[model samples]
Structure formats: C-alpha cells, structure tokens
Target chain A: MEALFFEKLKEILEITDRELSANDKFKEYSEWDSLANLSVIAMIDEEFGVVIDNSEFKNIQTLGELMAEIKKRTK
Target chain B: MLLSTHHNISIKGLAVAVPSGRISVDSFYPSFGEDIVQKFSEMAGVKQITRSIDQQTASDLGYIAAKKLIIEKNIDTNEIGVLVFVSQKPDYRSPATAFVLQHRLGLGKEVICLDINLACSGFVYGLQTTLSLLKNSSKKKALLITADTSNKTLSPEDRTMIMLFGDSGSAVLLEKEDQGNAVFQFGLRSNGYKFKSIITPAGAFRNRDLPNKVEEWADGIKRSDYNTHMKGMDVFGFSITDVPNLIIDFLEATKTETSHYDVVALHQANIYILKQISRKVKIPFEKIPVSIDRYGNNSSNSIPLLLADHFEGKSQVLKILISGFGAGLSWACGSIAMDTKDILPIIITDDIYTQGDFKSSEHD
Candidate 1:
C-alpha cells in the first residue's frame, strides 16, 4: 500500500526522485503551488472518493503524510 | 491642440480581405484534436477563421485586402496620400511594408508610407496615428491597413497560438468627406516591461548568430522564433485587471456609459477574457459584437475586420465601441459612429458547416 501510494504520488506530482530522506519538505520541492494543491485535491477526490476540506491541506506537509491521511480516510 | 474644438473625422470606407483558404473550428479540430480545439474555440468564442496557406507572407494578405478596397471604392490609386501598414510581421526587417504595398497598389512614390509594428492594440493606434497625420498634413485620403500572417511564425506543436490566430487584413480609407464616420474618444495604454511575457525568443539581432541557443529554446525550426509566445495566465490577469480600468477612464473622458453605445467590438483575444471583461464592466453579452469564432485573433485587424464584416450592406447609423488588446501588454478602446450601408458584402466561404454538425464530417 505504501509503495502504491508513493507511485501514485510520483505520477500525480511528476516527482522524479524516488527516495526521500527524512526531514524533506514537500512544499520546499519545486512542484508545490496552488495549482498543484488543487490537482492533489482533485486526485484525492477522484481516486479515494474522499472529499478533503481546504483546511486539511495545511496539515499535509509531505507525500508520505498525504498518503497516510488518505489511507486512514479510506479505511 | 489649436484645432477647432467641435470637429470630427469619419471613417469614409472600411473593407476586409482574408485569405482564400478558410478553416472552420469544426474542420480545424482534427488537426489539433477534437477535445482541445473545442475547448479553445469555446474559450475564445471563435466559430470560424480564415487563413492563406498558399501565401507565404502576411503582406500578401494585406495586398489582397487593399486591392479589394481600391476596387470596391472605385477610387484612383493616386488619391491615396498616406498609407499606414500595421503588423508585427513584415516581409523584411529594414524596408517598410507600406512601401511594398504602395508600389503594389500603384500609389505614387510621393505617398507617405510607413509601418506601425503592433498587434492586438494596433488598429486603434493606427487609427489615432492616421487621424493625427490627416489633421496636420495636406494628405486628403489615408489608408490604414492591418494584416498578419501568424501561421508562418507558428509551430504545429504550438496549440495556444495555432488555435488562436488566423491570417487576415482590413483596409479603412479615411477621407475628408462630409457625413463621414465619427471618431469618438479613444483610450490607449501600454506596459513595455511585460513585453517579454509574450514574445518570440529568437530572430532579428537578438538571436541572429546564436542559432544553437535559439534552437535550444525553440527546439529546432527557425520559424519557431517567428511565432507568438504568450504567457496565457499572465495575459489573462493583465487583461482582467487593466482593461476595466482603461474602459472606465475612456468612459469618463468621453462622458459616455455602457448603455449608450449601440455595439461594442472588442479585440477577439479569447471568449473567456472578453466574457470576464463584460462581467467586470456589467455590459450585456448581446451588446458586444463577436467575430472571433469565425476569425481567430487577427492581431491589430480583429476589431476592424469584425466591423467590416458586421457593417457590410447594413444601412443604419451605427455607434460602435471598438477596443483591441494584446502583446506589448497593450490595449486601446474607443467609439466610432458610421453608416453601415457604405460597406460592401462580406461572405464566409470556408468551413460552411455550422457548429455541432461535426458528427457528419469525417474530420471530426
């Protein structure tokens, strides 16, 4: 599930790097923006059928964190 | 400024000549793909557009349009005193296109011929310049010609510009005849700093020797440097923010309201941007005349081309609000009053199939 989530994140955000070291921030990476955020929101809704609020985006700091949240919500 | 306060110059004649090859949005869709073309057409409000595939340069299109005007008006070529050729695309860099056109139209060597390098905001600026020249000079008749051949500059991969632009030209003959079209208040503004925001990266002195560097940016194809490059989101933001303010300033200066004008002809940039402007200014959609669907954005000629098409054979005192906005981050809008009946008939030959009839055509 974690690998699948990482693959999905890589595809959605077009992230090239496969490995992420500890303390790496997703926002600090090049792909983070309002457009990307909206895209991610759309991806979440389409993939998981989970309607995440705009406020929830503030809590997500990394791909791992977003994947965890989606897993929890889906469960 | 010493001229009489209560005087006006009218548009004596207006004519448009487009390329022989016409491509409707329906027929054009297959080249770009149905989904993208449909979205672009819907967004730009362009139903049909004309192009001159056989003609290599935009000057050819301009010459055709000029010829048509001269023939239709039955005016002697010697009568033309001033010729203003407005286009970003000229056949040569140094020699003015106006001169070429002057010779083509058989206008005498004494005629004052010049080129104004502008696009979206060109028609209004050309009009303003021509009017100023006419006011001061002894030139009795002036020809304002706006033409562009964007396809030559475009790449097949360039969906944004390819779907948006069409080759077209318009010739407006200004003479000192009684009961001519009235040129009302005009508002012109530009921000040159944003010029790089919408421009081809190569060509001319900047990238003449550095072919490799240009190839790196434009990906081969020397003509790629000729095509227009626009940052769509930035242009949209600029249009939405600046256009309304300029319109308000124009209204204030002219002492007119939105409801006062009979028809508003906007620079056919895109349907979405125009819609946003209409909403911002609270102008009814029906009040605005749209020709973008049939004719893609024709740079400086969009407004005049539309007017020439709409006013043809229609006998009525028409008060029109004309505005054009585009590259150079420029915009110009104004009002003109004229009798629509003076213009000849305009026919849409290419892409005769109406919208939504795409299913019948295999091109769809």
Candidate 2:
C-alpha cells in the first residue's frame, strides 16, 4: 500500500522520485498549483473512492498525509 | 476618427464558401445540450447551423468564397489589388491567412494581403477598414474575406458559445465606382475592459505559459479555458446597452431615420438579443433580416453571408442598415444600398463538422 501510494504520487507530480520523506511538503514543489490540486482530487476519488473537498486540501499536504487520510477514511 | 470625405465603395461581387458537411437543427441540436440548443433556437431562431469538416479550415472557406466570386463574376485574379481577410482563426500566427488565400487564388505578388482578427463585429469593421485602405491607397480593387472556425477553439461543453457560432467564410469584392452602393457611413466603438467577456483564455500574451503549462491544460479533463468563454449576461448587457445607442448615433450622424432603410442586417448574435435590440431601436420586426435561424452566428461572416443568402436571385432597391457587435466589446453599424436584381444565385447550407467527422446532410 505504501509503494502504491508513492507510485500514484510520482505519477501525479510527474516526478522521478519513487519515495517521499515523511516531512516532505508537496506544495513546496513547483508542480503544485490549482491544476495539480484538481488532478490530485481526481486521482484520490478514482483510486481510493475518497472524496477530497476543496477546504480539506490543506490537511493532505504530503503523499504520506494523503495516504494516511485515505487509510483512515477507508478503514 | 471621422472621415473628412466620403468615398463610395462598390461591392462589385460576392461569394460564400460553406463546409460540405451540413446538419439540420434536429441532428445538430442533440449534440449540444438540449437546454442550450433550445435556448439558442428560441433566441437566434436558428433551426440549423452549417458547419465545416476537419479538412476545411476557415481560410479554406474564405478561399472557396473568393473562388466562386471570381468565377461567377468572371473577374481576372490579377485585377485584385488588395486582399483583406477578416478572421479570428488565421491559418497561422505568423503568415496571415490573406497570404495563404492570395497564393491559393493566384493573386499577383503586387496585391497587398493582410488579416484582421475580429470576430462577431468583423463584417462592419472589415468594411470600415477596407474603405480607409481604399481611400488612402491607390488600390482599385479589394477583396474582403471574413471567416471563422469557432469549433477549433470551442469545446463541446461550452454550450453558450457553441450554439451561437458556425464555421464559414465570405468574400466581397470592393472597387471604386461612381453611383455604386450607397456611401457607407459607420459608427464603430470598442471597450477593452470587456475583452475577457469573450475570449479563449490560452495561447496569447496574458495566458501564455511554458510548454509544460499548455501540456497540463491539454491533459486535464476540464478544457473550458481553451474554448471561447463569455459571461453571457455581461455580453448580452453590452450588446443591448450599446447597440441601440450606436444605431441611433449612426442615424443622427447620417441624418437618416429607420424608415429610410428597406432592410436592417444586425449581427445575428441570437434571436432574443436581436428582437430586444430591434424593439429598443424601434425597428419593425419584418424589416430585420435574420439568417441566424438557419446559420448560427458565423462571426465575421454573419452580415455579408446573410446578405448573400437573402439577396440571392432577388431584384429590388434594398437599403440595408447593418450592425455587428461582439468579442472585443466592439460594435459597428452602417448603412448601404444595392439593386439586388442582377445578383447571382448563392447557396446557404447548415452542414457542420463534429469531432473530425463529417455529418451527412441532415437538412437536404
């Protein structure tokens, strides 16, 4: 599940990195913008059936954070 | 700027090029969302809109129009001294569509070819520009071509703009002749503040981004920004608020009244907008020539294309008050006259190309 989460994150970010450090801030990356937010929301909704509201974007700032939220909601 | 001296420019000939694929309101209406199509039908009175196929671009349509005009009128290609192409969709950003058209038509190298990037108000503005060019320069004959392929810039989800536009081109040959069509007196106005009211929010200076940004927008599911976007209410307000005043101003300047015009050819933005403006300006409904019902707004080609369609094979002394408004927050109104008795037979159709496929004639 961790590997799958990173895979999705790499695909979404178009980054070469296979793993994200826990403290990594996704927004600090140059790829993050309104378009990236929408893409991430779509990815989350399609992959995990987890609906991400616009306001909740601040909570899921990193790949680990997003995966944690998804696991919490799915469980 | 006002003209110190008025020069009579003759529309010696006219030709129109429509896409081969045609769709009636029935077939085409379903493609657009039902509500939007219904609203357009109600407003523009367009029962059908002729559209182009993938192989045919806006310049192609212009070329076709010019070809037909030259053929039917038996005018030599070498005689055309100036070529003005009025289009929002040029063949390329660098070389003007007029250059392509001039090459295709075998027009001489001496001919001055240029393109104008105006949309809905294109015909009137083109006329105004052509008149100035003719009067200033020693050019004797000019070809004014107005064409638009709104489908290239529009997405299927953009119901408001999609229903209002059709792909087509028209050509009018203007020559200096005494006792020709009535001297064209124009009232033109543009307000850049409302530029965003109608635009494709990509590919130009304000929206230009790196190649990566374009790729991002392209890959995204939502492609609204690439299509023509108009705050419908704002554009409607602009049209209704400004058009009547502009018409009145033109009438005042020319010292003429509505009764003097045998027909009024206002931009076929939509039926409701036309009717409202007609009511506001106190022009009788019958006096207004509306091709919007059959051909959705053909952008720059709307007025002359409508004139070509309506006046084909008709003989009468017709005084026309034509007005066009859109896109640049631009508005232009003018008056001209023609004896339509000797005009050639012209065909108008509602064939539109969709998703790179030519929909066979639904109207015929």
Candidate 3:
C-alpha cells in the first residue's frame, strides 16, 4: 500500500520514488502550484475514494504528512 | 422529469457564426507567464478562442448565422412565425434583441419575437420551448437564435473566467412537418440555491450599488463586480456530482440507452468538466464531441457549434443527446434524432449586420 501510494504521488508530483523521500517537502517541487494541488486532490479521490477538502491540504507540507492524511482518511 | 414534444417538428437547418478574431492561449504567455498559461491550458483544455470585436455583438453573430441558414436552405422569411433569441448578453436592456433581429432579418411584422435571458443551458431550453410552440400552434416555422458575447463581461485578470469563455452565436431553423423523423425528449432542472456559485454581481439592479472595480483577490487572481465570478471548486463539484446523474436520469426518461445516440454534446464548459461527466456517465470519450479546444465555452451557442463543427458536409441519420448546464444554475438534457442534411456548415464571418443588409433572395 505504501509503495502504491508513493507511486501515484510520484506520478502526480512528477518525481521518482527514489527522489521522493518522506521528508521531501511540497515546497521543494517546482510543480507545487494551484493546478498541481487540485490534481493531487483529484488523484487521491479517484484512486482512494476519499474526499480531501482544500482546507485540509494546507495542513500537510511534506510527503510523509500527505501520506499520513490519506492513511487516516482511508481508515 | 422526462418530457417529449406532442407533435413532430424537424430541424431543417443549423448554422454557427464566430467572429473572425482568434486568440490563442499562447498569446497570454507575456501577460500570465508561460508556466501559468501552460498550466491553465492543460487544466482548462482550451487552446484557442474566437472573440468578437468591439464593433460586433452577440446579436450580430446570431444574425449572420440565421441569414446564412435561411439563404442556404432557401427558407421563406414570411413563413417564420416565431423568432426567439436566447442570450444572457442582449443588445439592449430595454427592447428585446429578438425584436431587433426580426427587423434586421426582414421577417414579417406578424412574427412573434422575444428574448430569453439564459446562458449555458439556453440552447436546450430554447429547443424545448420552440418544440412546444410549434407542436401546439399552427405556426409552420420558428427561428431559434442562441448567442453569447460573454467574453465582453470578463476581466482579463480573473483567472477563473478569462481563460474559459469565448464568443459565438448560432441559429437553428425548426419547421413543422407531418411524420417528421425528429423525436425530442428532454430532462430539465435548476438549483437556485447554489446561484452564488457563478454570478455577475454588479450589473443587475440588486447589486447596482456596488462598485465594479477589479481588485486583487486570493492566489493572484483579480476580479470585480462587473466581471463574471465562478467558484471553481464548487462548480467542479456540482458538475461532477449533478451532471452524470442528470444524464442517467435523462436517458431513463427518454427511454434510451447510453449507446443509443450517435453523438453527445454537452455544454463546452471545458474539456475537463465534459470528460469527467462522460466518465461518470460511462460514455466513451469519443462519443462526446468537444469543440472547446477551438471555440472555448461559447455558452448557449456551444451545442449547435459542436454540431456544425462535427457534422459539416456530412450526411447520415443521427440520434444526438445534447445537454447544456450553467448560470441560473440551470441544466437541460435532451435527445434529438435528425439527418445530417439538417446541419449546415459553420460560417465564420466578420460582417456586422445593419438594417437593410439582409434582403430575401426571392426579392432579388
């Protein structure tokens, strides 16, 4: 499940899992703009059947945090 | 609810006219930065848009399209018993634009003329109304003109609207025919509760007190009371949630299956929204004809524009499912079965019509 989640995130963020460490920050990515933000949310919903509000997106900053949020929503 | 016309009325002709001025998304690279422009282009699924010049208006384009249809199809002006103009952007605030068109088109004085103030859903609703009028009355013909010059109402800095809308107008000629092959069934709906999801706050009487000045909003977007504002996330949610269900209900109401129609034309809101609707409705993406990549969202004119663009110079029996949803928070979906001969090739013209410019060829 972790590998699959990272694969989807890597595809969305346009990075390889080798480059996407848990500590890697969204701010570090050049693609972290409004469009990517929405794309990530849509990807999560489409892949996980979990709804993430725009407000909730700001609370997570790193790859680890985003994964945690999705894990909680899946739970 | 599902509704079907009681009498047979055939669509004899259809024509769309867009202004000759074309603006490519890449043209905005200097203004919006290439990165943002590219991102927006990917997200909105718009490549280029046609815009009317200051000298042209929605009525101008619609007039041109109607004239072309009437001339090319050899429709008699005196036989057009009704002229309905469906637009959110009319030529004037007082006199209905349809009345102006009646005079400009040289229709007889007895022709009924009126304007319906609607935007995205205007075409389907206009088609339903025209079908009902022709079905109940002795009128043999009606001209339904759906147009939008909504590009004029936009703020270039408003990222939500600026990249999404284009200007266009279309004319559809409907004639009463005995045992005509046209069969129309419709599903219409509106939710005024979510009206604020898309609105122009200042031009109307209720919001007239507010100043229409563009101000920098959050996330580098700018807007004003005069400009159209849309809550992008809310609209996306509403469309994804409502549109698919509407299509499902419409199919059930019309007694048809998803695979029944030859083509489905949803309002050219954007490629993203249309594709989402198609996916949710379980229709193949190829079945949904998309013209937004070229014309942008021309509001009510989009469905006919899609037909004109897709079926131009083609001849075949077509069962088409068309849905239009937007402003008024309104939506209408319907099925129309017609022949390709009924759809005229799209005509792009820069000609701005004036009084006496359109004379019946019969007079010549």
User: Could you tell which candidate, 1 or 3, scores higher by TM-score?
Assistant: 3
Give the TM-score (vs. native) of candidate 1. Answer: 0.75
Evaluate every candidate with DockQ and list the scores.
Answer: 0.04, 0.01, 0.30
* C-alpha local distance difference test of each model: 0.71, 0.74, 0.82
Q: Best candidate, DockQ-wise?
A: 3
Candidate 1: segments with Cα more than 4 A from true spot: A1-75, B1-6, B24-33, B177-183, B212-226, B347-364
Candidate 3 per-residue lDDT over residues A1-75, each given as its tens digit: 667777887787677535567887875687677667767766776777665665566677887888888889899
Instruction: Summarize candidate 3's per-residue lDDT along B30-95 as a digit string, tens digits.
Output: 888997888788878999989888768899999999999889999889988889999988877768
Give the number of the best model, judged by lDDT: 3
Which of 1 and 3 is ahead in DockQ?
A: 3
lDDT of 1 by residue, B1-364 (tens): 0111113677767777676676677776666678657656655677777776643466666676677778878887777788999998887776898888887788976678999989888998888888777766666788998988776667656666666788877788877655533555678888997888678767778777544222323322223455556665556656665786688778777778999988988888877667767876778989877788778888888887788767677789888877888889788887777778766555322221122122556765
- The CAPRI-style docking tier of model 2 reads incorrect
Q: What share of the true interface contacts does each candidate keep?
A: 0.00, 0.00, 0.14
For model 3 chain B, the run of ten residues with the poorest summed lDDT? B353-362
Per-prediction TM-score: 0.75, 0.74, 0.88
The numbered model that scores best in TM-score is 3
